[model samples]
Target: MKAVIQRTANANVTVDNQKVGEIEEGLVVLLGVTHEDGLEDAEYLAKKITNLRIFEDDSGKMNRSLKDVDGSLLSISQFTLYGDTRKGRRPNFMQAAGPEAAEELYEQFNDFVRKENVPVETGKFGAMMDVQLTNNGPVTLILESRE
Candidate 1:
């Protein structure tokens, strides 16, 4: 499991010219699942993301977690996070989970976040999505469960 977490003033996903999911003053989470990912990974990542203290506090210090700020989450499935580009000119996606497994884990991850009582929105899995966001502070971080 992996995720690219970005603090955003607002974010939304569109599919076939239709908006699917949207959020404001939250995190745009590009989530990825690999073959080895399981419930534990989903649980851990969800907890970490919700509690991540990237939002600034009143003193202008980056010390407020998403929960602290009552922020939302826009989760998008992105298997390409596992793309291995070390060889040749093309990237290999052999490490990414198959569709069935990936979708299941993706839903699980979203469910985990929702269980935390945080507003959670999501993009359609396996769909070609156009995501738009006003990245707050342009703050981005990559999180991996395995390491």
Candidate 2:
């Protein structure tokens, strides 16, 4: 499992002009599942993301965890993260998990995050979603369960 985490002041996802999910003062998690991902990977990533000290402290240091700041999360399923474009103009998605498997793990990841008591909003899986966010600090990071 992999994630592109971005700190945001506000975010929302729309499907066909309808808002599906939204959040404020949180992280936008673009989550991807690979063929090798499992429940353990999802669990590990959820725990780590919730506890990462990426938020600023009173002194302006990035020292507060998402839980510490009472923040929320916008989780989006993103199979494209695994697109392999090494040898072709068109990318290959061989590394991405099958739809059924990916959706299961994606839900597991969200459930795990919610278990940590942090609010989780999500876009519809496998749908074409339009996501908008005001990226606070423009802070972005990539995290992988296996890494």
| Candidate 2 ranges beyond 4 A from true positions | none
Per-model C-alpha RMSD: 0.5, 0.5
**Against the true structure, what is each candidate's TM-score?**
0.99, 0.99
User: Which candidate should be chosen as best, given lDDT against the real structure?
Assistant: 2
Judge candidate 1 at residue 77 and give its lDDT.
99
Task: Give the per-residue lDDT digits (tens) of candidate 2, residues 29-112.
Answer: 999999999999999999999999999999999999999999999999999999999996999999999999999999999999
Candidate 1 wrong stretches, greater than 4 Å: none
Q: In candidate 1, what are the lDDT values of residues 1-147, reduced to their tens digit?
A: 999999999999999999999999999999999999999999899999999999999999999999999999999999999999999999999999999999999999999999988899999999999999999998999999888
